[model samples]
Target: MFRFALSLTLALLATQATAAEAEPRWMVTTTGGAFARDNDQAHSFGSLAVTRKIGRGYVSASVTRFGSAVRQVDVTLPSTYTIGFLSAGAVHGAWFYDGYVSLGRQHYKSVVTDLGERDVAGFSHSPVYGAGGDLGAVRWIGRSWSVTPSASLQWIKSRALRGQIGPRGGSEFETRETGVTLGAGLRVDKFFGASHGDSVSLRLTRFQTTNASAALSSGMRGAFNPSAQSGRTSDAWAEVGASATWRVDHRLYLDVGAVRTLGALGGDMTTGSAGARLLF
Candidate 1:
């Protein structure tokens, strides 16, 4: 899955490169964020990306590190995720499209507590891969206002045992999940500030699992036993978010964003992010 996405991205870069008529512009961005669930699970992450301008679009690559200490009731799951992404987007008249491919791995340490720690034999790190794309249209209300309606599709496949301590310390269990997410949203944007270069946006989106399944197997000694189960599950979320970008100068920009979600799967989730971008 990741290989296909990478290949497509490279091909796009090649095509864009051939059509270029002038020197390309570039931007570097660094972002950091924290995510929290109402149930007390939390994680923070940071990322860096370099993007190149090509005609009406851009191509970029980024890497992100999600820090450790995703907590559970009786145990603390100290795990780290390192993900790399390839993304490309372009604007065509009033319409725009973009997509991304992500490849990552989750590394987990042994289950730990205040008293002691235990290693679950036969447990190892897992590979993660996913791809997502969105298409939207822009409608200008005036010189400084615009509205956009968009739809998106995303797919992911990965293991889910990184933050789980299982039924027992060495009980030996593994879970695999494959899911497809569908989203639709409307966004409104307004440009403000003296130069009108600083802008803010408000968005409302709904995302639901269209096709999702999870398989679990459990037993000691790496056995495939009767306890295994595979089934389909449905989950949905409604999210509202606001984000703003401040153009400090011609070469630098700052961004801040916050989001709130109402969902059935993990209760309500709140996420906040801040970032800076430098143009060259």
Candidate 2:
């Protein structure tokens, strides 16, 4: 019994020493991607994220931007959108969880502008915000490959301002909507190299949303009156994507991902992304 206890104590000390030597307590990543839908124009997006380890968890801040142009008959519309995010998350054993909040804006060129102003269209703007949580687990099947399944839920709200030039000179309308989205997905990862290996991943996801918009007595949405819109609507969507990460060294990796989103108002969308991560 005495010998066994001493051996156990030595083993515990060795484990502690190994963990203390692990590299990378902080990381930064940036990603860029583009999406195109059927009968609609293509849009490009990019994001930057900074993350740091804290105890058993991590905290991150991110910013994202999107740009696009759409053509309607002889009129052309161009727009820009942006999002800012902050997240706190943890990976414990085989399970991980991420909780985040995001603030964003959407700007789109108005196709409803006056006929004479078709060459220089008016613009509509929407301010959006959301809070969400993600949960997942990593399960390794062998030494070089693993799989993860995840589920996420989020609440998003958007208030849009539409402006156009009219016979009255100019007019604006305000519309507000809220959405609760739920998603579930699975990913498979394959790893190469001996230490801090390069990896590739594939994923598929399905989602559903319950949406509500405020409508007015005129049957229009987003009225200043409290009772204008008291009801809500819903929708469902799905997506599939693949990504790969190439490890440049112990503290850097390059990333790429492509995904297709389905069941949105316009149609299905295909998007591709590339990025890099640095650890220190």
Candidate 3:
């Protein structure tokens, strides 16, 4: 965790050092939602990002944290943290490309339960790493509107045991997955009393998996065949979200939004969030 934080701090410093003198640009967002049948489990996430102009493009970095808790159970899962590095290619007229790589770490905790006068529990932890990249283009459609489309791929590898039932009876597992995601959105400038700099956006996205693997330690094995494993068990689903950002000043802003999954993923996983941003 310390290393991740340090890396992000250095990246931010380097970006700021090379930034051109212009209007401050930065974003911070927080989101929380529930998952599971009947919304029995809840998840929360938050992120901070900053962007600065460099040459004809932009450089940015962001840090994020997310965790989940059960509704009826008193157990809270460990939180995960991620740091990202981003580069935006020079704009060619009205088109450009953006890419990013991210490093992530997941921390897990033991589960605890109380039955009559007995307390039962077990705990464990693991660290996972992943990288992802994206390519996107934006084109002006008219005076106050534009369209952006993007595609992204992500992969993650598990490094240790992710869960446990008891201290003495636990197994190690590793996971690998690759995902392809596509997104399209429309941006409208100066809507609902917002300034020209302020914008509202509606976006739809779909994510599909091409490969997935789950490997267990020799001592802790399951009947599931390794050949039968696939990266994603569920089919692709669409997500729709709306966001509006209002600038309180050149350095301060507010952003809010709601996102819901449109198909199968929607039944148990939907999220809504709002947050603030500060630039320096």
Candidate 4:
């Protein structure tokens, strides 16, 4: 009887402590990470996100930047591509939901030594947009730490533009591409240290894209090969990645993640990122 009373007292104290550790009404985060592939050049990724409370839900806006290297025909340099989006979401108990639409410009940067040692060119450029939603739930089930599972889907469209650079000037050849992506993931979070709010979260995800393109739409057929046909082509690929996040303080956090893709019509690609987060 005495032990039972002690357990009840401890449970009430734990509940009161959790209630005192308030969740943020507004927050912002930024993360940046590097990417590497088995046989390809490296890429860089970064994002900035903002969130605010709204009637049991939250409104969010985010901007993302990614830089990648592509096969060079005539001195093609690498440049960062960008995306910006707005999202609406709700978090109730252990479940959360979010929907967002994003738009961005795609670009491949390159230098044209033939035109001028300092000349730069861009190819296979396009404007891209996508809409996506994510749903997830956390289940503690009487454990010290909780686990969350999430799933997401999105549709994307890109306007393809092929670029050529020479002694004369640069030109763009235009085309189009469309695809859809599906993803599922799980995350585990554990809190340590004297402050139960200090936590570490690890997530793993698998994603697949349909109607992906093997190569950028080049305006011209393979180097004087009249028999070659040039148009839109699509394929598919799958990728998996893991990420970790650490709470530095009540208002600060840090994160890192890595991903690797396979069956990418061209070659396998790997990506990585790390960033800091803030809550208010």
For model 4, residues 196-240, the per-residue Cα lDDT tens digits are 544455555555655443221111000000111134444445545
What's the TM-score of each model vs. the native? 0.78, 0.75, 0.64, 0.71
Regions of model 2 farther than 4 Å from truth: 1-21, 68-78, 107-126, 161-172, 212-233, 263-265
By TM-score, the better pick of 1 and 3 is: 1
User: Which lDDT tens digits does candidate 1 get at residues 58-101?
Assistant: 78898877644434455565656687878888777777788888
lDDT of 3: 0.41
User: How many residue-pair clashes does candidate 3 contain?
Assistant: 2
Better of 3 and 4 by lDDT: 4
Going through the candidates in the order shown, the clash numbers are: 0, 2, 2, 7
Indicate which candidate wins on TM-score: 1
* Count: clashes, candidate 4: 7
Residue pairs with backbone overlap in model 3: 110-123, 212-231
Candidate 3 local lDDT, 209-274, one digit each (tens): 443222110100010012113234434445566767675764565666665555543243455566
Query: Which lDDT tens digits does candidate 2 get at residues 107-200?
Result: 7654444354432334456686877777777777876677778887777776544344479665544557776767788878776763535667
lDDT, candidate 4, equals 0.52
* Deviation (Å) of 234 in candidate 4: 5.0
